[model samples]
Every structure is written in C-alpha cells, then in structure tokens.
Target: MVSTNPYNDFLKECQMALQNSIATLHLSIPAISFSLDAPPSPEFGELTSTISFEIGKKIKQQPRSLAKQIVSSIDVKDFPLMSAAKFAGTGYINFYANFAELSKITIDSTLALNDAYGHVQTEKPKNVIVEHTSANPISPINIGKARNPILGDALARILAARGHAVFRHFYIDDVGRQTAVVAYGYKKLGRPSLKEKPDHEIGLIYTLTSCIIEIIRLKLALEKQRNVSTEIKQKLQMQLEDWSSIAAELKGKHPRLFTELLEKISEDKDTENLINKLNQAYEAGEEEAKGLVREVCQLSLDGIKETLTNAEIFFDSWDWESEFTWNSDVTKTLKALKKTGYAFQEGPVLEFDADKVAEDYKLKHMLGIKDDHEIPSLTLTRADGTTLYTTRDIPYSLWKFRKADKVINVVGMEQKLPQQQLKLALWALGYANHAKNLTHFAHNLVTLPGYKMSSRRGRYITFDEVMKEAVKRAREEVEKRSPQLSKEEKERISRIVGIGALKYALIEVDPTKRVVFTWDRVINFERNSAPYIQYSYARSRSILRRVKETPKKFDYSLLTKPLEHDIIWELARYPEVFIISAENFKPNTIADHANLLADKFNSFYTAFPVIKAKPEALSEARLGLVKAVSIVLRNSLSLLGIIAPEKM
Candidate 1:
C-alpha cells in the first residue's frame, strides 16, 4: 500500500544496514551525508556506495580493510530486494538486487498507480507562476523562438504533477516600438482585412515599412555628409550599403508590398517622428494610440492563439504590459526605490545604481556576482518620460509575487543581464525574499541547417508552417506502415505522432545547449525520438491484445533475464527521475527517462518471446511486465506534454 519510490526505499534499507553496522563497531565519526550511485556498468552491480572510504579515513583504517570487515558483519540475506552485498575496487560496496522480488514490486506498483505511476506529491505545496513565450506580436512564432513555450509548458506540467498550484502567464508587449511601427503600417494601408494569416500579413507590412524607413534615413544622412570629411563620408557610405542590401532583399521577397509602402512612406516627411510619437503615446495611454496599437496587436494575437492551440498549448492568463504602466504599478515601484536611495536622476532620465545596491546589501555572492565585477547602472526611463521594458517588468514581477510563492521567467539566454538587473532591482526595494525566489530559466536558441531566421526581413518559418509539414511527413510514414487502418484512424494517429515529434525534439535536448533541428532527427524511429517511444508503447499494447486473456496472478520469478532486469530497474527509478526533473526545472530529465525505458523495453521484446512462451506461467508474467512498461511509458510522455498513441 506504500506509494513511496521503490528505488529510494531500497536505498533507505541499505543506509539503515550501514548505520546499524557503524553503531555496533563503535566507530567515532561525524554525521555522514553521502550519496549512492549506480555503477558505471551493470557488471559492477545495481547500486554502489563508497561510504566505507569516508568512514575508514575518519577511523584511521584502510578503506579495503574496512569494507571487508563491514561486509563480513552485515547479513546480505536480511535485505528484501538485494541478493548480495560485496566489496569491489578499493572500498566500493556493490549491492545486487534480487530481481525476482524487485520485479514484483515494480510491476504491481505501476499497475496499481496507473496514470499516477511516477508522480510524487509534496507535503507542502506552493503556488507557482511560470511566464514564458511572450514573443512580440509583430509576427508568428518561428522555430527559432519555439523553445520558450515548449520548455515552459513542460515545466508547468511537472510542477502540477508534483502537487503545486501553477499559473501560466503570457505578457503581451504591445507598447514597444516594433509594434508601433507595425501599427503605423497597418493604419497607413487603411487597416485592410487580412487575406492570409493575420500575423503573416502584419509581418509583411512590418518588413516593408522598416525597409523603406531605413532607406529614407540613410539617404538623408548621405546628403548631409556630402561636404564632410573623407573618413565620415566612408562610414556613411558603408551604412548606406547595408541598408541598400536589405532593401534589395525585401523588394525581391515582396515586390508589390515593398513598392506600395515605399511610395507611401516616402511621401510622408515625418514618418520616423510619427512612429516615435506613437510609441510614447501608447505608453502614456493616449486614447488614439491605445485604440490603433491594440487593434493591430489583437489581430496578430488571434493568429498566435491559433498556432498555440494547434500545439495544445494554453495559458491561464494573458497579462498586458501597458496595464502595469497605466495602473500606477510602475510609478509606485519607482517611488519606493527612490525612497531607498537606489533610484537617482541622470539629467532628465531616471537610473538605478544596481552595483551600489548589491554592495550595500552584501548580496554579491547571492546574486552570482564576483568581487571584481562591475555592474552597470540600469536606465529606467527615456528623456521623453516613457518607462523602459525592464522597468515595467519590475512591477510585473512584483504583481506575480503577490499571487505565487515563486516566479520563473523562461526567457532567452541573451537577456541574462536584464534578468539579473530585475532581480537586483527587487532587492533594492527591500523585497529581498521575492528577489531570491525569482528564477530566470534561460534557454539557448534553435537553428535549422543552412537557414537563418530574421523577423525584421520577414524571412522565417512560422510554427503553423512547421506543424503542417511535420504532420504531412508523419502521415506518409503512418500510411506506409499501417495501410489497413481507416482514414479517420490514420489521421488521428498522424496528428499525435507529428505533434509529439515536434514537442519531444524541442525538449529532449538540454536547455543550455543549442538544437540544430532537422526533420530526420525529429522523425527518426530508430532511437531517442518520440516515434520510437510511441512505437514501443504500441508494440506492448499489441502484445496484450493478442494474448486475449488476463492472468489472475503473476509470478515475478519468471522475469529473470538480463533485459527483463534492466527494464525492471529503469521502471523502479521513475519516481526519482520525476522528482529530480521538477526540482531542477529541467523537463529533459523526463524525456531522457522515457527514451531509456523504451530502449530497455524494446530490448526485452527482442530477447524474449512473450504471448508465445513454452510455459503459460512465464508468458503471463511477461505480459504483466509489458503492461507495466506501457503504463510507465505513457506516464513519462505525459510529463513532456506528449501523447503516447496505441497505433503509431
């Protein structure tokens, strides 16, 4: 009836035996905190502990001699799931599990828990907020920017499974200059109805408008430099070349849109000033600016929502950045910092002395800053009195802390400095606890081969486009494998397989590592991909369906092969894996565990004949093992926000 992890349970037994032996020997040593590690290879043993060396050092005895004495004194037969405990190497104590008994415990617990097989609930749960994927509303999310939402959603799933109340938030950045320019383009074009995806249209308009504006700015600078020094003229000429190249590329991509926008933007002498005014007005909540920018942002968000929903990603709340500025949160936060002497005025602009605050509070070590490091002061506002993005984010961070115990900002690695500054700003306002609890879960980028993505030039693949291609590729594979399936069934399977492949590929790699994404890697059925795992699950289910009979009881002793033992060991470690992934905010751990379990299960399938064994008792037990494997695989995939189809 115990729901505790079997692997941890076994470790506890080992630790208790060691503790008792130390007491009987009267060994004088400080309380030891040590860990047990799996041997490098199965030849060593299932679990190995090096506590003997530490204890021997303290007692002034040789490690091997101490290990021998401990082994002779301890009774290996006393352990429930361990068959033998012996000394190896210098002082390592290797413990081998009694696979017969271990298999029974693993299979029974998995079947009993079913969908809740690996998750462990905490006694003290917390309310957590995870903010991610707040991509600008100017364009659809491209593959390069897809990692943020995928990682965030996976983290949220793991936390909820661990019994935390989680809230997923997306901060809509509609008050930025990029959005203001996009809005200007939309308004200049008479706010025409989108003939294609709303975001795609917005992206086209943004690129055309940007290209034209650059050409105009460069021309004016070149005209002014005609009588200047040769050095200055060369610099201006280089700038013009860069803008001209971009203009050429933009024109080639969208000829008609570029020509129309060029004519319109060229005729307007104050286009640059107008965009700047719109940005400032939006921040100040002017009715005209608010109506125009919000309308453009809303249209783009409609397209974004469609793509995310297709990927099965949803948010609990959509927070607007402008709301914080409009609701006086930014104003109040600045005033509080000024009172604490952290805020000061540099000319007409406001700034925060982050380095001084860290020195005064003795927070260098806690903030991960070296003693010789010099932190720069952060600019809070422009000379025109408009607050910066990070300044607004400070108020938003405080708002999140009001409803949650911890806040995780899943931002890109390039924003490390800004994220750190935000935390320090919180500490400056005397919210040290909040600052300490704030985590910047930074992730690297994703790239495709031979292709570079640039939103400014409107040269990027949207998430919707990627999903469509994946599904089309998956459907072809599914049809080739299961030609007899109905059209409806094939479609269903293809959708699950396609989306699963995309999600798994994004998450299977470490977040700190860059992913060179390729369809071959994502859709591979051989190893380490979602399809491989899904197919393994389906094979298990296929076995169950063929048997056509359930065993009232199973014999664990029948499952004693090496491959079987490997599967049982991997299954027993699921709870530990789940707990570690949640604690570290790394969903790749879950992905790794799933792929490993599937590999072991597939090996077991090839090595043994289940449902066709000579002895009925062995066949029934193997069937029970397959059922457990299927349950654990499904549970593991769910943690990564993937579906395990029975007919992939």
Candidate 2:
C-alpha cells in the first residue's frame, strides 16, 4: 500500500495482480479496464471484481474455467497487501487484505501525518473564490439565511485542504432599494444610538418605518377615492386595515422607535419620492447618499461579523456591491453586453436576450435542458433607469472572475433561474470561459417546524439568538453529564459543542434538501450529530490520557477481530472520501463519513478493551488504533470548521 492512500494503493495492486494472473495463464485478451470495488459482505474479503463476466460475453468462453485459471495462477508473493485470492461462486475473484501489514502502515502513517492525514493533494490546484451569505442589508441574518456562510466556509476549507488557493468572500448586496429603505428608516428615526445589537436595531428601524409609511400611503389613497367602485373600495379598505394592524403590532413591541419614526417621517411631504431620490443618489455615487447608507450598512455588518465569528466562520474579503457601481464596472459590463447585440431596449426598460444567446450558442442540451425549453429574458433595468439585482450581479461576477480561476456562488435554491440568467448574460458578453468556470452552489432553505419566517414583518429568529440558546442548552447537558468538571472547563466545552451542533445540523443534510431543524435532532448525543462524534473523540483522548505513555512496537497481528478490520479499512479510505467530497462540492460527504467512523469506533470499544486487554502488546495495538481514529475525527471536524472538544 502507498504511504498515505492505503486503500487506493490496494486497489491499484489488485488490478496489477489480475493482469499478472492473465499473463501467466498464457491467454491473449485485449486491453480492458475493470472496476474493482468492495464486495457486498466482509466475508468475501476486501475487494471483488466481476470483469471476467464481461470478458466472458465478449470472448464467448467458459467464465468458470477462466476464473479458476486466474485464481490458481495468481502469485500472492508479488502483492504484499494481499493475503490470498479466492474464486468465490462463478466469475468472481475476491482479495483478502493482509491486516497485520495493512494495520501497521495505516496507523503509523496516520500518526505521522497527524493533522494532514487525509488532505490528499490534487495535481491541478486552482485559484478558487467562494461568495455567499449576501443577505439583504435591511435586517439581521435570520436562521433561514444562515446556511450560506456555513456551507461557503466549509467549501473554502475543503478546497484549501486539497491544495487549492481558496478565498472566502461575502458580497454585501447594499446597492438596492432594500438598503435604501433601511437607510431611509434609519435617517427618519434620527439615526439614534443602537439600543441592542446594531443589526437588530437597524432591523427594527427598517420594519417600523416601512410599516408606518405603508399605512400613511394607504390612508392618503383612501381619502382621495371619490366615486370609486364598491369592490375597489372594499379592497382598498381591507389593505388599509392590514397595514394599520401591522403598524399597531410594531408600536406594541417598540413604542419609542415607532413614535420617533412616525413623527419624523410624517414631517416629509413626499416620503416615497424622497426614498426614490435616495436610491438613485446612492447608485449615482452622490456623497451624502453614499455616506448615509454606507454608515448604516457598515454598522449592521459589524454586528453580522460578530455573529459569524461566534460560529468560527470567517471570510477573506467583504466585497461591497456599491463599489462595483461606483467604479464604473457596471457601466463597462453594460456597454460590453450592448456591443454583443444581446442587449435590447424593451420600451423604457432594458432587457437581455437570454434565449437568443442560448439558441445562437446551441447550448440548450449542453445546459442539461431540452431544445424546446425557452428561457425568459432577464430584466436589466427598471423604467426609471435603476438597475435590477441580477443586472448588478453581472458586474460582480466579472469582478470575481478577475481574481480567480473558478467562482462559486452559494445561494438559495429559489435563485436558480436568476443564476442561470446571470451565467447566460456573462456568455452573451463574450466571457464564455468565465461563464464555464462559474458555479451556482444552490442549496435549499432551512425551516423550523411550526414556524414561517418573514423578514418584512420581523417574524423570524436571528442567528445570534439561536447560537446563544444552543450554548445555554449545551451547558445544561454538560452539567448533567459531567457535574464534577470545573466551571471554566464546562463553559469552554459547551461553546464548542453548541456551535458545532448548530453547524452540523445545517450541513449534514444534502444541499438540495430542506433541513427541518429542531433541538432534539441537533443536540442528540446518542446519534449522528456533531456531539456524538466529538464525544467519541473525547473518549479516545480520555483513554490515552489515562495510559500516559506511547506504546513501543504495537503488535499489529493481534488486531484480528472483524471490528478492528472495519475500522482499519475506514481509516485507510478516508483520503479518498475527502477527495470525493472536495471534487463534488459536497460537505455532507465528510459529515456522513465521520458519523459512520464514530459509530464503528464506539462499537469496537464497547466490545473490546483498549487498556485492560489480556496482553500488553494487544493493549498497545488497540491504543494505536484509537489514536488514529481520534486524529481523523479531529481533521474531519476541522474541515467542517468544527472544534473537537477534549472533555465534553
């Protein structure tokens, strides 16, 4: 076996052994590649191949004879990792591993490499960029929007581990009407000192200001409705009642904020026009507008960074969406697209001909869609000459490609269509290579049972609040489980356990599936949760701490049990699993593999003793296995941006 990739080396040796057998048998067969994989059961040895079955159909010979000849002619001496080659049933050759040598190589290599045990290096490393968590600057990040940063950070970590120059980024979507409305609300409320976290305070200001301004507009509309139809009047009346109720609710929760915003906003005669002017000025690079909006955004972002830091999610850059606009990147992008003849005027608004580009490029099937499937054109700007969200994203995408060979945007599943449009727009602008390298890492939403979150109504749970509650609950669990620990020790472990549980819950599910989050599922210590893996690691450390010395010359031959073999195989295959996870952009693969390893480790320790085994050599060998498992666990958790606690 190779030093680092023991399983992969075994696989390569299996193929070579087969070729050697065929050559010795004196059979002339054409060059054919065979797929070698683990058999259905462990009793069939380590790996099984059915290439003889395919060869039988092509050669029109007796497969049973061929199988017998190959097994009899195989020389086990040539492959040190193979103990024997057995011809199981018909047309099947199974190979058993030499566990003694395999175990020594796997465990020793694992301990030697330690932290970098499973980080297999890729031959072609890339300069990759990951942008995510571009939440609207109007409100604090809610639980539903929290998946982006966690997944994005994990992706960057995984790629970096695989020898890629990866960069994590957060795109601040503050160049839109949402930011304008929030800034307007902040200004109307006298830009008061924050009464809570900056994001929370800004959210309250935005919600109250929006609700009140809506009510005012509705009331004014109702006043001017003379001789209107009865049905129209009823609809208007219902709408006014809804806004009034929303305003009342806001006032009930924040009386001072509501009163302050109402008094200040009512003083402006044309509040809607003022907001539009602010939006236009902000996009046009006006000083007063930029100063006012950027101040509130920066404050809110500071609070956002605090929440992300608590979860150990950090970024290399925080790219402002407004900067692209101010630096003329958006203008240059628009002009470039226009020159490509894909940009056309649809009345007073501008539109990009996406379908025409797809048709011209003949990329419908290449895009995994049918030829008849029509793509709707993307709106570039409004009638008032203000750019849309995706229009601004075009320039931002170009900016990212300038600094990277590949760009991955971690966004929600709902934005799949818009992302497709963004890519098509890039291609239409003659950035075909950039479009090819771009990826939309789309993920589904996170939902708590019995709760529907709406940012506009301020009816959602904040990430900060969730982290605090998770930690508090974790502390209770820690106290119940280990009451003798010191307060500081318990506090430290609780933070690690709590934050790890939250992140695991978000990332364990497949990215295409919605996560139904609940505390019972997240903090469970007995199942496939982060706490389970962390506890298993802690238990391994506990055994080593009690022993207090490294074992000299562990007897690898003594590890003969099925559970030990299972663990050895898993530890050996970890590097391959990591490569699959990184190449496929799936963090859940690592999570899944970690849970399985933890399960097997627990089962082994439960059935076999590590420190109290009959002979000292056997005890030391088991300890070696335990240490290897612990190292892999710590590395896997680190890739997920999770901490492995030593005493949780």
Candidate 3:
C-alpha cells in the first residue's frame, strides 16, 4: 500500500477548492499563500483559514462577503473527508471533517504503516552532521551539561527518520589548558591508579591542583608587589585572600588529596609555567605531552562512556580537537584567512577582523548582529603562537562540512558569540557556503533545585549519579505498584522507566527554556511525564491481550462519540506532527503531542467499554483505535530518545 498523510490530504482539498472558487468567480487570485490553522476550540471546526480577509482587501470587497462567496463555491460533497464548509467569525472559513470517513482513513493507514505510521522520507535528503556534548574531559558529565547530548541525539533520530544521512559526533576537547592541568596533577601524583571512577578521581585532582596553583600564583604576585604602590599591594592581598578561601573549601572536601598535591606543587616553583608548557607542547605534537594528556583524557572518557551507554546515548564518531592541530588543519585555516585579507597582525598575535567581515559581507542580520552593535576582533593566536579554541573550531567546522551538507554544533548559549565568530571566520576565509550551512543549536543550562553546580570546583552531580538515583526511585514506585512481580522483572521495568523518565524530562522542554530538574518531576506517573504515557501504552496492550480477538474488519462508522473523534483526529495528525518537529528541529513538539494523545486515549478508555459493547462491530472499531494509539505513542516517544515500556 502507498503511504499517505491524512492531514496533507485535507490541505490539498482545501487548496484545490480555493483554486476552483477563484475560477468560478472570475476573480484574480492573489499571489499570497495563507496558512490553515486549527481552531482554538473544537467548536469552531477542525481547520480554519483566514485567507478570505486578505483576498477581500485585494479585490475591494468586504471580508464577510468574500468568505460567503468562497464557502458557496466549495462543494462539501466533492471532498471525501470534509462534512461541511461554512463562514464564521466575520471572515474565517471553517471546515469540519467527516468523522466516519476520517476515522476509517486514520485507522486503516495506521494499521497498514505500523511502526512507520508517523515518519516520512523526504524526496530531497542531505548529509547532516550533529556535533554535541563536547564537554571538557576534566570532569564527568553532569545534569547541567546533559541537555546538549539529549537534544542532539533526538535531532539525529528525527532527521534519520526523515531520510537524512545523519552523523552524530562528540568533539573531544583534549588539547586545552584544562586537560593539561588535570594531566599535570595526575603526573605529580606519579600517575596513581584510580581508586574510584576515573572521572571522579581525575576531577578531584583537577580541582585540588587548580586551587593550589592559584594560591601559589597569588603569593608570588604579592611577593613581587612588596616594593610597588600601596594600592597595588592592597589589590594583590585581596586576590590572595580569595584564593585562600577556595583552598579552604578544597581542603574540606578532599583533604588528603589536596594536602598531597599542595606539598608536591609547592616544591616546584614553576608549576604554572609547566602547565602552559605542556599545553603548548601538546599542540606542537610533543610525544611526551601527547601521551600523558591522552592517557588522562582517555581515563575520564572511559567513565563518560559507561554513563552514556547506560543512558542509551552513543556517537557515530569521536573527533579529537588535537587531531586537527596535529594534522595541520589549523595551519591551513590560518593561511586561508590571511590570504582573504581578514586576518591581521596585532603585535606578536594574529586577529581576525570579525567586524570588518560582518560589515563587508552585509551579514549583520544573518549573524544576528545589529547595525549599532560593535563586535570586537577575535584573537586567532597568542603572543607565543598558541592557537585559541575558536581558531581551532574554524578548521573543525570545515572538516565536518567536508563530509556533510550541513553541520550543527549543539553548544551552550554562553558560547553563542564564539559560534558566531566561528561562522564569521568561515565567511572571511571564502567558504561562505559552509558558513551559511553551519547551525548553532544553542541551549540554556539545567538547574537543580536549591543547588548551584560548578565543574571547576568538583561540586556537580555526575550523570551516573542521576541515573542511579532515578532507577532507585523508580524501583520503589514499581514495587509499590506491582509487588508480585519477580525480582528480575521489577529490575528490568525500573531500568526502562527510570531512563525513560530522565530522557523525557530533558527533551520535553523547549531547548531555550531552563529546566529545574527534580526527582518528583522526572518520575511523575500522573500528568505530562514519560511514565504516564508509557502506562497508557501498557494499558492499551493489556486491553488487547485480554480481549484476545483480532479485528479482521473494523466498522469505522461506529466510532462516532466525541472521545473517539478526538483520538481519530490526533492519530490522523501524527504524520504532520512528525514532519513539523523534524523539519523545525523541535523535539518538544513530539513530546507535547504524545501527552495530548495519551490524554485522549485515557479519556476514551474511561468513557467507553470496548470488550463489553453490545454490538460486535463497535468493539472491533474501538480495538482498532486502541491499537493505533499504542503505535503512535511508541513512535512519538522513540522520536524523543525515549522508550515506551510494555509494562510499567
């Protein structure tokens, strides 16, 4: 059978009817294409169009009169799914669906498509790359940075469903000063074996090492200020006091490790210079520096991989930031920028003239820069010839585009300026097409209630910790609900529900919105939560299993009640929802749709009895409806990186 979109069918009918109306009235049709929006309330109709108002103004006629004319020209009998077309609210034309026909079409299509009910393959597909969750390997993944991977994974899933060749990437930032600091601490401790998870162990060393280094640097500055002005001496004292407070805090958390690192670091007078040297050597491909940094980063990444695997997050490629530097990609990028007249020398450093490029290319609007706004030049290299992060990112962006038509960087909102600068650098280097195709999928931070997390201070909750807690909480709830289930079954159910709840909570909110994540909200089984929808699906399956009867034929006309109509309407619109969500890169739409669909299905379950219906035809139709809802709920959840559990 050929696949079809029921909503798209309705849209085509409306467009064709409007064209016919224009021909019948001998009126010139305006070139403006208007949208058909669903009415605010079901009482108004299923689909409402306000195009008559625009057309009326064009033809010098009143809107109400034009609407009546258009309504008169539409023969509702000619449409298969529409029952009537009428004018309402001054100029809006509302078209009501023929529920019996629509219900039949929806059920038939759903039963035929099964798992492929909502997804559609685009005729024109492009190779797309989604790079996200490139968090620094110094610490474990936390809830604050969890949004990037969740959103990126959902986008990759949706685009692949839409027939795009999607590639998921995690750009390992192992070449920066942060990694060097962690590696420095590890080496100072004689590369001790981790007594705990590698990430947690490495994080403690990083934070403790950072604290001691700051104290040393501040004390040295104070000693040098002994002969300076009193004002300068006072400023240096304030800085030293701040570091003293951080040192105290670190000592309280990890006293043994802090004391050891402090003794080891204090013995060396040039610890800061050593870290800087390690950073530069790593970038310059020094084997010793490369080996040590990679070893530390790999240990942290091993723990990260375990956490991601538990959460069902995986990547197609793990791109290393150091690879680009070592392969001369950064050097080639600098040479290209210099040849484009966009790169200039500022003393010993090189800077990209971002403001000049934005103005020269007239990219103010495209780059979200206002005419009165002043963007500063971006430094490409330091005085000592060390490249900046954004400078390396330019080459990485080009590398990503080499294999894909579009590249989306799922970075945080705080990095919007740098992402914009990366794109601008691409434009200045004469790769305007690559610049245009680059996407900055910026997302806001996640906040836990009453707690502020800081990775630098080793005060954040790791992703593994959150997942473990979610499962533990879910286990309690599962036991309370189904105490008779075997231990193995309960554990399995808890794992699925727990992971589903976390993934759902993360992706259900808009990317631009901040999520105050809490256990109460994540594991909610009542309203607007993953467990609620999963329970609904399980309930549907239970009903079908109990009946043990297959509906070889369904009499769709029997499903005419208001609740049935609601379910049918939503089921028919599932394909359209999938299309809009994928095309717009909005997974929240699918999440919202799943909740609404579950609500309708539950209402129908309460208001009507399928198995006890007096007429066998009605029972079969209701069974068909239940099956369709189950299929749709599962498909919708899958789009959001969630699994619809068979049993809750």
Residue 314 of candidate 3: its Cα lDDT?
89
What local distance difference test score does each model get? 0.86, 0.87, 0.87
- Tell me the number of clashing residue pairs for each predicted model: 0, 0, 0
lDDT of 2 by residue, 84-108 (tens): 8888788788998989888988898
Q: Give one digit per residue, the lDDT tens place, for model 1 in 392-466.
A: 999999999999999999999989888888989999888999998999999997877776677886667777887
Show model 2 residue runs off by greater than 4 Å: 22-33, 60-69, 215-245, 450-452
- The TM-scores, one per candidate, come to 0.97, 0.94, 0.97
Reference-based TM-score, model 2? 0.94
Between the candidate structures 1 and 2, which one is better when assessed by lDDT? 2
* lDDT, model 1, position 357: 83
Candidate 1 global TM-score: 0.97
**Candidate 3 lDDT over residue span 429-525, tens digit each:** 8899999999998888787787657776666777788888889988999999989889998999898888888888888889998888776765566
lDDT of 2 at 467: 84
2 versus 3: better TM-score goes to: 3
